[model samples]
Target: MSRRLVILRHARAEHGFAGPDHDRSLTESGRAQALEAGRRLALAGLVPDHVICSTATRTRQTLDGVLAELPARPSVEFEESAYAADLDTAFALINAADPDVGTLLLVGHNPTMADLASAFIDDPGLVSFPPASLAVVDLEVEWLYAAPGTGDGRILDGEGQVGKGEG
Candidate 1:
């Protein structure tokens, strides 16, 4: 069955947090970007069936803002592994997804998201997943079989600085 993967990089975050990197929260602009990204997803009719998000504060906040704009809430899992996930870890999570989930949203930090996006498509240079950016990829393979360069898919659409006026 065909699957759709929507990869989102956490929005702009506060840089000087006294705590750990996972504790950093989204800035005002990041919050706005998350809200805008959510609205764009809703408007585009790309509500996900499942969302696998990082446990980091910024990513959680991003998910919250995005969820606020979605018409229907999907099944969500906040995983600690996604906090600083590499490409392989990200793919492992994707591969473990339920087969019934036709559309999946993975929200985390970069450059893993960027790497994963590049892997799904034919050309790595075709996209750049900046902060708060979303990449929509249409995969020809099932979630269990998804892998780098194996999934026959292309970037259906993308939005950079989504909620911000910049893009």
Candidate 2:
């Protein structure tokens, strides 16, 4: 079966917050960006059936903002391992996603988010996952079989522009 994977980086966060890095909250602009991102995803018809998010303050806030713009609320898993995960770790998390979900969203930090997106596309250079940016990839495999360079990915910004890989 074909599946859609949405990889999103958390929005811009407060840099000088008097808290741990993981506890930093999103700034005003980040909140706006997160909302825009949700609208973009909706516009592209990529609403997720499940969400696997990092257990970080900024990521959680971003998810909330994105969810606010969506019509349906999908099941969510808050994963601590995604907070500062590398490519392999992120892959492991994604591999563990529920097989019944047709579309899955992974909200977390970068360059892990960017790296994960890059790994799935034909051209890694086509990926540019800045804050609040997301990439929607269509993979012809089960969730457990997800791997690098196995999908056709298109990166999207909050403005809804699509950046496709050169397959």
The model with the greatest TM-score is 2
For all candidates in order, the CA lDDT equals 0.83, 0.87
Model 1 scores worst on lDDT over the 10 consecutive residues at 158-167
lDDT for model 2, please: 0.87
Which pairs of residues clash in candidate 1, taking residues 3 or more apart in a chain or in different chains? none
Off by over 4 Å in 2: 158-161, 165-167
Screening candidate 2 with a backbone cut-off below 3 angstroms (N, C-alpha, C), the clashing residue pairs are none
lDDT of 1 by residue, 1-167 (tens): 66888888899999989999989999999999899889878877889999999999999999999999999999999998999789989999999999999999999998898788777656535556678877777777888888876654444334422221121
Q: Candidate 2: lDDT of 6?
A: 94
So what's the TM-score on candidate 1? 0.88
Q: TM-score for all predictions?
A: 0.88, 0.93
- Total clashing residue pairs per candidate? 0, 0
